[model samples]
Target: MNSNIDLKELWAKQETGIPDTKDLVKRVASFKRAHLKQVIYANILLLLVAVFIVLVWYYFQPEYITTKSGIVLIILAILAYLFSYNQSIPLLLKSSYEMSSADYLQQLLSLKRKQQFLEGIMTNLYFILLSTGLFLYMIEYTMRMKLPLGIFCYGITAGWIAFNWFYIKPKTIRKQREKIDGLINKFHLLTEQLTEKK
Candidate 1:
């Protein structure tokens, strides 16, 4: 109704301190870098654990073939987890800081979906593999031990595994999803702000 208003002139005079799209993208890039570093550290730790397991198997050389197979399974699971994790980090790091708001939002959403999949399906698979591998490896050793000792060992092992699968994993997944969802919402809001008329 205000035909006399010069919209373009008003827009040109708009405040400069509003959230800059490039700055948002830079923030996202920094987040990705931090996440990548965590991933690298976690993968390295996993590799070290795998190496330790292999060393134990090599030096001990349990008489049962099942024990050897269990060790192999554990190694395979670790390698699989590493490969899956490495695939995502490079993709995440590829998001350009100069990307437009809409493009960056799309990237963020895609990354969120990928993260959910990783946290849900891949995580479950990894834990399952670990639990099974450990069970198989422990079977021969447990059988040779006295009944009370075997019960105590298996009880502690089962308790720890249960705690991880039921509590730690779900809590971790929830936190991860919350973080990514928060980022996604932030990007959406930023995009809206960028697109809004002054």
Candidate 2:
């Protein structure tokens, strides 16, 4: 008796289809090898820049560094940069498998999901850098108790960020929504593959 098996039927029950595990692992491995090198190098550069900023701030403004706030912010900046740098590129690199068949396509799509997550993480890291820079500049003026042009520049920068965030954040959210859709599509494929394998 030949009973036609449609694995996709099972996948339809779930929100995201589970693809064949064999293809999943191999696809992830292959992607990591091809994509991570440049991304890692870029992150390393960002880390170096963060380190340089810390050194410069410490060297030039030892007198102004009475409060621990500036120091804490600097440390936080360094940490955020390092985290994004380490987490994303390595995640990308981990996808170094062979995608010989379409089986791995599901896993590759999952990798894209992780990549989107990394994008959010990196976005936060960049925000930290921007906020810290503004805080430090403001503190410098506040410490001296002097009203100067530099203070005005900082205020303007803050206002600009606020304005852009107010307007631009929605656009960013929309883009993220698209990424989510892409992820879902890939997941569906994965599920289809899994059902077939079964």
Best by lDDT: 1
Q: Where is model 1 poorest over a 10-residue stretch in terms of lDDT?
A: 1-10
Predicted candidate 2 versus true structure: per-residue lDDT over 39-80, tens digit per residue: 667667867866776786677665555334655575566677
Alpha-carbon TM-score of each model against the true structure = 0.71, 0.54
Q: Kindly list the per-residue Cα lDDT of model 1 for residues 90-168, writing each as its tens digit.
A: 7666777788767887777777678667757766777888888887888899999999999999999999989988998
lDDT for position 159 in model 1:
95
- Predicted structure 1: lDDT: 0.82
Q: In order, what lDDT does every prediction score?
A: 0.82, 0.65
Runs of candidate 1 with Cα error greater than 4 angstroms are: 1-40, 97-99, 191-198
